[model samples]
Target chain A: MIIECRNLKKTYVADGQAVTAVDDVNLSIAAGDFAIILGHSGSGKTTLLSMIGGLTTPDSGEVLVNGIENWHQSDARLTEMRNQTIGFIFQFASLIPTLTALENILLPLSFGNRKAASSRQARDILAQVGLKDRENAFPAQLSGGQQRRIAIARAFINQPAIILADEPTGDLDEDTEQEILAVFHEYHRQGTTFVVVTHNVHLADSQESPRILHMRKGVLSEENPARTRAA
Target chain B: MQILARQINVLDYALSSLWRRRMKNLSVLLVFTAVIFLVASFQMTTGALTRTAERVLENAPQITLQRMSAGRQVDIPPEYAARLSSIYGISRIVPRVWGYYFDEVTGANLTVMGLATDRMPMGDQLHLALASGSFPGPGSRGSVVLGRAVNDMVQARGSHLLSLFRNDLSMASFEISGVFADATDILTRDLVVMNIDDARDLFRIRGDRATDLCVYVTNPNEINTIARKIADLLPDTRVVTRPQILKTYRVVFGWRSGFGSICLLTALTAFIILAWDKASGLSQEEKREIAILKVLGWQTADILAVRFWESLLVSGISFLVGVTLAFIHVAFFDAALFRPIMVGWSVIFPPFHLVPEMTAQVVLLIFCLSVLPYLAATVIPAWHTASVPADSALSGA
Candidate 1:
């Protein structure tokens, strides 16, 4: 299994009240599987994704990515795993405002060992995102859709085995959302395992044989178990 | 090599981040530079003054003897030199006559020294560099060697002669023989050297009495012993040694500079407070930026490295600029802002250029006092922000 979770739980204290974000959630994803988690706002989809990415520690249970327990590793090793083994696309256009589109795409490589050919690879990725001519533009200079594309390109620069996106097209127009979904399909065809969390249920229709799961009030239930890839 | 390259990349991003907030950072930089300038200027000026004092006093008399009667200094009889000549270690005894002349026209105090022309040349002994013309020759009674400042004052009045009122209110005029060089102006600015008889006549001194006795010793190591002997032999006399004079100058300059530093402490405290506030109170945008970087797989150490680079760039640039400006202020413009405070009040203040003396220890001290505090201020907040879980910070929890 590329990603696995057993009875994972997370609770947050807000205004002196304990709110359970994710409770007793169990999940497994195989290599090259396309899994779409459907949930409304405050449904704990992001919290579960964060645990699988080694971004948050679960209050109980454990998360295993690539057979290594996420919370069991040292901080350095976990950070390295996040950098090399998992890619994340946040809800907003999270490109660094001071960096140009190309530089933002190359941001992940800066944290790890960057090869001499990585610059060329970044330019190639920019061209693949149909933003080759906009590489020199800063985030502020780009439209929301262009900025999202740059962020998506940044996530793919390190070529991680797992791509976890949270509402990657949350605020985009219908056409822009379809454009981003098409880019995702292209990467999925190249055999990258994807676990995308979103409120847009229409995204499930774009994937063939996608394993769809529904999360409501911190509880997760499988909607398309027959489509799930056998692990 | 890969780690170094990664650090360089982070530093590049840090620079870009600072530039994005140029206006805010510029204000902090200006205040920081000003604080450094004030402290560095005081240090450099005081250091130069102390060194100049030591250099000028190197050729001073080994021991000076003055008579004290009724708790006031009185003229010692010239025959006292004869009494001191019998001491075993005493090499030569020279009775000197010098007094302060208050010029009513300029409201300045001038030092008038009487040179013994018949003995060894005082110019060579004191290293007096003549800027023009010559010193008063032996047996020359109506000629005087003027210091640079005194010469300027005399020449400003459109005269080639300096006229002074005698003790009896009678005016005496003397030809200006020469002007002292600018290099020696710090010591000679208010000095006027003339023949011994002319000084005695001007001051109305008795022929048998001299102002003081300058005693030289054959062995420098025996100076304190000789001074003690003279003090014991002449119980009414005050004995001062060269080392004692040097110590007094060091103490005076140190105290003055310390006072100047104290006066500037308020500004430094304000700056430190500003720095602390800026560092500890991370803006929401900055917090978000750190979160985004962490979510992009940057480690806490990487974030700290970026913050370290930012602080270092600000402080390093400020230090270089402040020290350079201070060097120019002391070496070229004569520390105009701090000279009056360090040198004290004087109507005829001598304008002397200070040699810029920056030692390794002084640079290190300034770095610790100014730069390290700012770096520490930045790192603590940076560590706090970086140590938070990326998801929690991104969620603004």
Candidate 2:
């Protein structure tokens, strides 16, 4: 398994009231399997993905990446895992504004011990995103679609076994949204495991062989493709 | 090595980030520089004052015998010089006649010192360039040598001769034979040098009495012993030693400089508050930047290291520029803004040049007070911000 979560639970308290974000979540994502967690806003999709990505620890139970318990590791080791074992694509294409597109793509390499190989990979990713001409341009100078393309390039620059994306297409227009989905489809064909969280049904429905999951009120359940397609 | 390179890259990014907000950071830099400049200028002035006092007192007489009656300085009989010469370890005793002459026209108190022509220190030690004629001859009574300041004041008043009213309600006059050079302005400004006999005659000291006796010892190491012996010999006399004078100078300068430091620290307190506010209150955009770094798998310590470099860059640049400007201001401009308060309220402001006494201790102190506090102030807020999960920061929570 590329990703595993056992009895995972996360809770937050706001204004003296305990709110469950994710509860008793058990999940497994096999290597090279592209999976999507479909949910409405505040349906614990992002929280579940965050825990699986090792960005946050669950209040109970454990998460193992590549059969190695991640939550029990030191923070440095966790960071190293995030650098080498997983990639993240945030909702807003969070490229550092001061850095060029190429530099933004190369940022994750800074957390790891690789510099030269990562620099070459960052350049190759920029070219792959068709933003080779805009490598030196800052994010503010790029269009929304172009910025998102660079963000996608940054996400997979490390060639991680699994990529976790949270609402990746939520901020895009219809045309740009389709373009980003095409990129995801292209990456999925390359046998990279994807655990994507999104509210858009088209993302899960469009996949020919999708392992879809539905989340509602912090509860996760396997979705029947026939029902999703009929809906 | 890879970690170091990565950190260097991050520092480069930090520089770019700071440059984007240069306008805001410039204000902090200017204010920080100003605080450092004020503190440095004050320190440099006090250091210079202390050094000048030491140099002037280096070759001065080891012991000065003054007649004191009920805690007031009185004129000693000239016979004390002869009596002091016979004391052990006394090489030479010179009876010096010096008194303060208040120049009413300029409102400056000019020191009138009488010296034996044969006994003045030669060459540069004389501190006089002989702007005009010559020192008054030994036998030349009622003849005086005026300092440049005193000469200018008397000449401005259309009088070439020094006019004085004697203690006996009689008038005396002295011819200005020459004026001492400008090089000695630090010590001799507002001074009138004359023959000992002329000084005695002008001041109306009856029957060969001099103002004080300056005793030079054969061995400098025996000054304290000789001072005690002199005190025993002249029970009603007061003896002043060079070390005592140096200590008094140190205390005076230290107290004055310490007070200036307190005042400067008041300004620094305001700066510290401003810095703390800026550091503690990270903007939404700034928080997001940290979040972005965290999402890229930067550890909390890495985030803090970036913040440390940012503060170090700001405070370090400010310190260098501030200290350099202060040196120029104090050494070259004669510490114009602070001289009046620091040098005292005298009309004759001495020409002072401060040596750059930036010892390792002082540099460390500047760092501790300015840079360290700045780093400390930012670290806490940065840690708090970094402690938040990257998922939340990226979500803009």
Candidate achieving the largest lDDT: 1
Specify the CAPRI tier of model 1: medium
Q: What residue runs in model 1 are displaced by over 4 Å at the alpha carbon?
A: A14-18, A113-124, A130-133, A136-143, A228-231, B68-75, B86-89, B100-109, B116-125, B128-146, B151-183, B194-209, B218-229, B346-350, B393-397
Count clashing residue pairs in model 1: 0
lDDT of each: 0.83, 0.79
Query: What are the iRMS values of all candidates?
Result: 2.1, 1.8
> Per-residue CA lDDT of candidate 2, range B172-229, in tens?
8888888765434455666788888778777777657878888878898998999999
User: Per-prediction TM-score, chain A only?
Assistant: 0.95, 0.91
lDDT of 2 at A209: 76
Among the numbered candidates, top DockQ falls to 1
The lowest-lDDT stretch of 10 consecutive residues in candidate 2 chain B is B120-129
